[model samples]
Target: MILGEFWRGLKSGIVELLSALIAAGLLFALGDSAILATITLSSFSSELKSESVLEVFLIDEITQDGIDSAKTYISSLSGVSNMTVKDPEAAMDEMSAILGSDMTDVLGFNPLPFSLEVRFEPGSCDADYLNRISSGIALRDEVMEVQYASEWLDNLEKLTRTTYIITGILLALVIISSLFIFVSLHRHISTRRRDIVRNLRLLGIPPQSLIVISMMRAIFVGIIAGAAGVGITILLWKLCCNYVVTIPFLTTGFTVLAIAAPVLLALISLLISAGRSQSNLFASGS
Candidate 1:
């Protein structure tokens, strides 16, 4: 008898089931995209940080000993990842390579000074920190200047921050909209089964039992919809994986969440709908 009722309910609500599936699928896709975007941004940020290098030039009057001492001191500083000292001759050679000719041959002298290329670890490439480091380095009598592309770093930071803010906003909106759709559809189903529910109540079937049946039907719908949605999302992700780079650690976790979120949301909405319907039924009886 229970099986018969379950089948009947499933057939009656097939349209609602399909609607919920499509809506949940879309929400899951958007959520997955947002997560991937965040991971991509972090990867890009790390790449930028790795490429960041600060050039510290030494005063021409400084000796080799001064340069060696300065290199040792800077290498020991906190937040300094790596440091390489380029002698005046090496600097001139690099410049000559770029210009396709030796400047010393044309001008009779190499004007370039010895410099240290300093690279910082990820998350330490900020303006204030760089400024502080530069100030400390300038205090040394052998140091001439500390230069980096601070503007470019600042701009990248701003852009990544904006992308995160926008992604968060869109994700929130999609969740709210999905929940609304689920609740609205559940309420519609409840109204359609109102007469049958009233007859069941009159037959001495407990309201709790009736609500359980409704919840069971909702669960069946949720499971089918969740599976379908997750399958579609995984398919799309696999298709795009070759074209895009994503973090391996986060991919599995996010995929699991995407699969579970829709079913959980559907069950919760159904619970709310059933409870509300039971309350109304008792109120009308009283």
Candidate 2:
């Protein structure tokens, strides 16, 4: 019966199937970890960028109306996310809290000028954009100075770029390794079933049926491998959850990909193997 032959084929290739499963599972885990780390770094980068603030100090001669106008102008700027006015008194209070002593007691008068704290949108935190915005704000008559930590922003930008490059390289390597594993496993399966396949072909069995059987076997192996990979990844993620930050949607998406990747790879491998085996068998017969 066909069922008996299918069982025999499954039993014969059990070792190859197990090897493929183990190799694919480990590779998938490595790939998932790299992706998760990249996402976490990106999240941290965005958070730090959101905290960046530009301080615009007002001239001593500027009236309250002038201060209000400056605030309104800065708030209306294209990239500005937020703008808060801190009067001289508030500035003094903040300095006092930092020093743990009343600044007024030592200075007799607040020397700090009224300033606007401006925060920009994430993509707008680059050095060039910040410089342009700061220069524009400085040109205003009421503005005495515009200051921000440009050096810090530059360094953060560099770090983000490096993370992206490294993540891309890692993903590429994982994909290549996965393809190699699938191809090698498919070849081994083809060799093991060579005699049986040749016999079936001579008996007038349709080539399509043989290809489908091989594909089914591959699909079965892939499902088992994908399940193992996903389980391992979930376990490792839980164990390291305290140290790593992850987005819920990203994690869910990666998990789905992990399960889907092996099956997809298997399908590709079976198609390749089927073509090669059919050709070799027909050539020998002729």
Candidate 3:
């Protein structure tokens, strides 16, 4: 009988229901997109960090013994994943590829210095860490200079931090706005059905039943809104993959959570709203 009243109430408030649904759906869609974008960017940043390498150039007069000693020392450094010694010839070839011409032929000699290309393990390198390692490497007797993209690393870190902050703010805004919409819709429905609720109360229908009815209706609206949100999110993801850089789709777990979160939020909102409304009803009835 309570559920019957819930459906009756739903059919009576079609306009209010549609308004809340659209509002919540758009908010959820935006939140999901932010989450997915953040995940993709973080993954991409990690891959780049893994590939980041420190270049240690050797002094011109360094002997083979010095090279071997340097290699052993660098290999023993903490977080050193791999190191490759690039001879002057190899360095020259790399420069040639970059310049699209043979630097050795132009200069009549390979002025490129021998260098050690060193990569660190994933999650082990950051701007400050690279700076410290490079500084320590430069202090070696046979080392000419140590170079790494410290600026780029700093920028990447900032970008990642900013992405998380923005995502957090977006989610907070969505939740707050969703709560407002839910409460407003609940009040509107209660006002419209006040007489019916009074009659039910006279017939011995407990106030708690009214709360349950409101919560159930909210959950039903939430499921529909969640579906609409996911649909919009999929469409946006496809557009991004087609025009922007490709990103991995949300996994099954994330997709399910994305759809379920709004429902949970809606249920909670109705609980709070219904609790307050029931309190008012009791006060008025007495």
Please tell me which predicted candidate would have the highest TM-score against the true structure.
3
Give a tens-digit lDDT track for model 2, residues 199-250: 8778987776776677777777667777777777667877878564643335
lDDT of 3 at 203: 91
> What are the per-residue Cα lDDT tens digits for candidate 3 across 10-82?
9787899899889888989998899888988888887788788999999998899999988998998888899
Residue pairs of candidate 1 with colliding backbone atoms: none
Models sorted by TM-score, best on top: 3, 2, 1
**Would you list the clashing residue pairs of candidate 2?**
none
**10 residues in a row with least lDDT, candidate 1:** 243-252
- C-alpha lDDT of residue 24 in model 2: 83
- Whole-model Cα lDDT of every candidate shown, in order: 0.75, 0.78, 0.84
**Most lDDT-accurate candidate:** 3
* lDDT measured at residue 101 in model 3 versus the true structure, 0 to 100: 99
Task: For residues 161-211, write the lDDT of model 1, one tens digit per residue.
Answer: 888888899878867776777777778777777787777777877666766
lDDT of 3 at 174: 86
- How high is each candidate's TM-score? 0.80, 0.84, 0.85
